[model samples]
Target chain A: MLRYLAKKLITLVALLFFVSITVFAVLFVLPGDPAQIILGINATPEALAALRADLGLDKSFWGQYREWVGNLLAGRSHHSIHYKMPVFDLIVDSLAVTGPMALMAMGFAVLISLPLGIYAARNQNRHGDVTVMFFTQLGLATPEFWFGILLILLLSVQLGWFSAGGFPGWAADPIGAFKALLLPAFALGVIRAAILTRLTRSSMLEVLREDYVRTARAKGLRERSVIYVHALRNALIPVLTIMGLQLGQLLAGAIIIENVYFLPGLGRLVFNAIGQRDLPVVRDIVLFMAAAVVVVNFVIDVAYAYVDPRIKIN
Target chain B: MNTPLLGIEELSVGFDTPEGKARAVDRVSFALERGETLGVVGESGCGKSVTALSILGLVPSPPGVIESGAIRFENSDLIGSPPEALRRIRGRDIAMIFQEPMTSLNPVLPIGRQVAEPLMVHRGLNRKEALDQAAQWLERVKIPDARRRMGDYPHHLSGGMRQRVMIAMAMVCRPKLLIADEPTTALDVTIQAQILALMVGLKQEMGMSLLLITHNLGVVAQMAARVVVMYAGQVVEEAVVSELFGRPFHPYTRGLLRSMPDPAGRPDGGSRRLSEIPGIVPAITEAIVGCKFAGRCPHAFGRCREQAPGLFDIAGGQRARCWLSRFPERRRTDA
Candidate 1:
């Protein structure tokens, strides 16, 4: 296990390096001048040149990339032109919203999917299964942002159940913070639950038919034990695989939903940074997103190994 | 006769498919006496496993339903019993092992935990106590270093060892009946013999009735006192093991016997092509009006094709479902 962890850690570093390169390369190819944008459009060429030199934008692409990476590692980092703070600190603030919202969305999804999926699977072909399936189909068909908008309209606008959008600082009022994010989190969570419910249902359906489940039943185990204990664990392996992939998706998917909710998440930060042409913030935020994806996938692999001992990490 | 431990009467199981309801076990009836081994022998898809699965009420529904039946165990009706009632009887009063040991046990669970599950569920033992008892079961099944081996997953065990674990699990509750559905089919020949031996030993030691379901005639010959032969969905014949082997009255039974490879070399000393039953078992969905084995039976007469024969007593505690068996009435008169 230690060897597996060490191997994963090494890959994580290499993956981060690759992600940094991709982010840098894409930004390098974009037709814009970061220094000029940071300075004003009416700024003199001398001022622009001095800003470029100060920012090290005049250096070769590879040379600039190495120095940027080295500085990031060495604790010397670039500041966001728009935010007027270090890029690292700017991203941390963005993540503060993104992390909680994503987790709450996923937490809600799992809460809904696990029971709904298991219930649907157990009552296969009955009204319970059909109804859940029909709702899931509707959930799957609706775009997450559209779903969020519909949620906002129904819950916040119509019923006044929750605030429409925006993140209240968690430290301010914990109850209010949760209530504020609830609608968006639910909006994000419902669509995921739709996909995950179907996944869990089918996976559970297959596991329910396995011989061990039969053996479990033969042992006169209660229906609950047979379904939840024996069948669910085996079914969970596949569901968990998708769940890992889905977590990363929820983060990326938060981009659109964040816009819809007016939430000050990384997605919004990236949107604003790109519009302002704050090269450092955009690059840093996107790099963080990429790193997040890599890290999520690594955690998933570790989790899969823990759930299913058959998985041997090389 | 002593009261049968389990009496299955007119039990027919059918699975609903897109096409229609396909009957898998058609009005199959059998009685298992206490401490007696009953071998149910048939080819693949002949409903051998389904019969065993139905006994536990473990056949997955929506697709499967007991069309009509009575499964009486300990004076209680098991068929259409409440889920709680069935669950109480299952794994407690009766336990079952399956055909494929490779997939029969939970892969993620420790072999010990799986073996101990029955004890925990039925015996009301705590986790620590149940697991300790599970180690004893493993040791009983002759798993070496049973205590230390408790933590290893199913993947760590060999095929035969896994089957032994399965047997251990089934017998852990000291169930009145242990239904082993082709438990040794997935193992090598030597391992198959060992598993069979182990099961028989466990059955005798536990004083449990054994329902050994297998397609192998030799396996039946070795382990069973009475043999019930099923073809397609019907019970084609039933007799004492020696009597069934000595004189198989049904043509399908005769075909099965002929198909068995000769353990002792033929006089010519060269391997001969083994005789096959000639035709595949009819698919259950196809509406067949006659004997399921007629197309495969060489002696299938006009009556065999036009209608199915009911089980007929062929004298001396043997019975066969065949038109030929009916002729014995006139033969006895002529004699």
Candidate 2:
């Protein structure tokens, strides 16, 4: 198991290395020059050259990559071209928003999916099953941003329960911050819950038919115990895999939902950075999202071995 | 007469398929007296397993439904009992072991927990008390290092060990009746013998009645006192093990014994071919006019094809469902 952990850790580092290189390379190949974008279109050729030199853009790709990676490792962040702030600080701030929102969205997704999925599976091909399937289908069909807008309309505009969009930082007011993220988190959760619910249902339906399930029933276990404890535990194995990937997707892909709520998350930071050609912030945030995905998957792999003892890490 | 430990009367179970309702078990009636081992013998798809499942009321729903029956246990009909009542009876009054030991156990759960569950569910034992008893049961089943092995999952054990675990789980509650559905079918010959001996020993030790379901006649000869032979979801014959083996009444029973490979080989050192009952058992979905086994019976005659014969009493407390069993002169008449 220790060997497995070590192997997984090594794989994570290697993956992050590859993601960093890819993120840096994409920016390198892109048309916009960060120096030109910062200095403006009317800037003299000399000004552009001086800014390029200062930004170390004149260096070879390998040289620049090594410097960028070394600075990141050494905790010396590059300055954001648009914001004129350290790239690391900007990312940290954005993470402060996205991290909690994503985590809350995931919590909602899991809380919603597990029970509904098990319920649908237990009543598979029945009325309850059909009802769950119908709603999940509708949930899957509706986009997250559109759902976010609807929640804002219902809860914010009509109900007067919350502000329409935007974040009240946690330090400023914890309750307000929680209330602010609830709608967006729920919007993200509803769509994700849809996918996860379907997965949970199908996975549970398959496990419920296994011979051990019959054994569980024969043991005189309550139907609740049989379905929830025996069947759900086995079903969660596949659900965990999807959940890991979906979490990664949620962290990186909540860009539109973040925009709909006007919340300044990592996705939003990356979005604005791309438009203004803030290469430093964009590069680091993209790497952060990629790393988040890789790390979540690594955790899930470890969790998978724990969930199914049949899967020996060795 | 004293009440049997478990009595199943006119039990018919059917499964709904895209094709139609496939009758898996048709009006099968049998009884296991207290401390008695009753064997239900048949080829695959002959309803032996279905009969076993029907006893526990564990038959899968949607696909499976009990058409009609009364499973009387301790004077109460389990078939008519509510779900809660049946559940209380299950793993308390009656427990079941399935054929696939490898798949029958919950893979994720520790064997110790699986064995201890019935104690928690029915016996109302606390976790610590249950675990203590579960470890004892594991040791009873002869698991090595029982206390240490408590934390081990199902996959850690070999086929024989897993089956032992299954036995431990089923018998942990000390159920009055243990329904073993081809318990050793998926084991090696040596393992099969070991499991059978273990089961017989445990049944004797607990003074529990056993319902052993198997296609292996030899197993029935070794383990069961009374045996019921089924073909195509119906009982072809039933008799005490000695009478059934010594003077088999039904042609199907006689054919089953004939099919056994002679362990000593041919006397002249010539390799004699073992006999086999030809033709597969009829599918339950097929509506038949007469005896279900007539198509495969060597002595099948016009009456056999025209009219279905019910189980008929014969000498030595045996019952056979064949016209020839009723009239010894029928074979000569056919000749």
Query: What is the lDDT of every predicted structure here?
Result: 0.86, 0.90
Listed per model, the TM-scores of chain A against the true chain A are 0.94, 0.96
Q: Which candidate leads in TM-score?
A: 2
lDDT of 2 by residue, A1-314 (tens): 78977887788789889989999899999898888888889999999999999999999999999999999999898899888899888888888888889899999999999999999998999999999999999999998888899999999999999999888898999999999889999998889999999999999999999999999999999998899888888999999999999888877748899899999888889999999888888888888888788888878888888889898786
- Per-residue lDDT for B22-45 in model 1, tens only? 999999999999999999999999
Q: What is the C-alpha interface RMSD of model 2?
A: 0.6
Worst 10 residues of 2 chain A by lDDT: A246-255
Stretches of candidate 2 off by over 4 Å are: B266-271, B332-335
Clashing pairs in 1: A218-B91, A219-B91, A220-B90, A220-B91
Predicted candidate 2 versus true structure: per-residue lDDT over B151-226, tens digit per residue: 9999999999999999999998899999999999999999999999999999999999999999998899999999
Structure candidate 2, residue pairs in collision: none
Report the lDDT of model 2 for residue A300: 88
TM-score quality measure for candidate 2 = 0.97
Chain B alone vs. reference chain B, TM-score for every model = 0.95, 0.97
